[model samples]
Target: MTTILVTGGTGTLGRLVTERLRADGHEVRVLSRRAQPYAVDLREGGAGLDAALEGVETVVHCASTQRGGDEQAAQNLIAAARRTGVAHLVYISIVGVDRVPLPYYRSKFAVERLIEESGLGWTVLRATQFHDLLVTLFQGLGKAPVMPLPAGVSDQPVEVAEVADRLNELALAAPAGRVTDMAGPEVRSLDSLARAYLRTTGRRRPVLNVPLFGKTYGAFRAGGHLAPDQAVGKVTFEEHLAHRFGR
Candidate 1:
């Protein structure tokens, strides 16, 4: 059995991947900032992380920091993996990180580069934004009387479970550098997505399309972070909402 270590193994996607791998009879090791038995920070490398990586043949890297320091985390992981002679490293990254100008997106792309040059056998999968994130945004926005959204912005939100399944498959296979992109089934406008959330959750709020002036927003407006061609995911945002809310 291939013993695979999953970073950020407790997160939405990683947790699913961990469960799937274990169910399939693979020995799964979970590593994260707070995961029990291997709660070491990847950014702050130490013997703790090294100890976790020992005998870890494959690493499914799902750990990511949107606040910052993702590049540092990848570097630390790469260094540790090299030392431990880990054969395969699988990374999950956001789609259009190379085209998007957002700071968080830039950091994701930088981490992708770090993994690419890490010299360890690696596979990277770029996926669209998860549906749960849209839910979070709408939840926050619905708190106010008026919801504000970037003008001309569209999103293709995929189910997190689907992304997790793909990651699990990648972790089990031989390293395939930069696999095909994963995307949601539909491309809907943010305004429409917000409306769907409001309608489903019964939140009465006027959605305001606020046109923001910035290169980052412009890129979003231009659909730089979208993948209309690779819409292969089976679940829809509404289906996810039904299951999440037990409706």
Candidate 2:
């Protein structure tokens, strides 16, 4: 049995991955800065890394700051993996990292590069935005009759569970360097999604399509945030919402 180490196991995706791996009967180790048997911050070298990765064959790295930080944190992981002679390293990244000018996206892009250049068996999965994110956005929309959204932008948001499943599969499979891009089955407008979600949850709100501005809006309007047509996932937004809300 391949013993795998999971960084950021406390996170939503990380926790899911850990649970799946454990259910599959694999030896799993979760690396968190706060836990008793955790590794320290990967930014600076520490003894905990050496201890955590001992006898681990594979690593699913979910440890990352959404906001960009010094690139050394990723570099440190690479260095630790190499030093420990670990076999495979897998990373989860965003779909539109290259197109999105956000700092977090830039940092993810850089981390992908570090993984690529590390010369270890590696697989990188770029996934679209999660459907849950829309729920978070709608929470702030208040009890208004109309939910406003950036008009003309498109998204192919996937269920976070689906993304986690793919990650688990890749973690067990041979490294493919980069896997097929993953995304939701449907392509829908931001306004339409918000509208549908409101109706789905019985929010009784109409969707107001507001005019978008600047490069971010333009990029999204051009479908830069979506995956290509060939890589549609099985889970749909309707099904995800239904499962989530117990509807």
Candidate 3:
């Protein structure tokens, strides 16, 4: 059995990856900020990481700081992976990191470059936003009677479990640089998504379309984060909501 270590193993996507890997009979070690069974903060480099990487053959990197500093954390992880002689480094990134001008996306793109030039076997998988994220966003906005959504913005939110399954597959295979992008089964406008969410949750909210003027919204409106050609996910947003809330 190949030993695998998953960074951010307690996170939403990371937790699913860890569970799938463990269920597949791989010896899985989870690295998290909390003091869990095999905890190691990627921001700090030390013996904890050394122990976490001990005899590990592959690492599925799912840890990320949504606020900032993702590049530094990735750098620390890369250094430790090199020291431990890891066989494969699998990184999960957003779909529009290169095209989007957001700070978080820029940080992810920088980390991708670092991994590509790290001289170690690596594979990067860029995926669309998760259904859970969309749900959370709609839930927050649904609290108001009139919800304002970004006009001309659309999303293809894939299921996290699908992304986790793909990560598991990539972890077991030989390193392949920049795999095909993953996306949800359908492309829906943010307005429609909000309406659907309201309908599903039994909320009566009028979605108001507000024009978003910014570089980030521009990229989103331009479909920078969309992979229409790579819509490989099978689950629909309605199905996801049904599963999530038993609607």
Best by TM-score: 1
Instruction: State in Å the error of residue 86, model 1.
Output: 0.2
**Segments in model 1 whose C-alpha atoms lie over 4 Å from true places:** none
Best by lDDT: 1
lDDT of each: 0.93, 0.83, 0.92
lDDT of 2 at 238: 80
- Give the TM-score (vs. native) of candidate 1: 0.99
Q: TM-score for every candidate vs. truth?
A: 0.99, 0.91, 0.98
The predictions' CA RMSDs to the true structure, in order, are 0.7, 2.0, 0.9
- Sort by lDDT, best first: 1, 3, 2
TM-score leaderboard ranking? 1, 3, 2
Q: Which stretches of candidate 3 lie over 4 Å from their true place?
A: none
**Candidate 2 global TM-score:** 0.91
**lDDT by residue for model 3 over 1-247, one digit each (tens)?**
9999999999999999999999999999999888577777677768888888989999999999887778888888889889999989999999999998998899999999999999889999999999999999988887887998999999999999999999999999999999999999999999988888889999998889999788999999999999999999999999999999898
In candidate 3, clashing pairs total 0
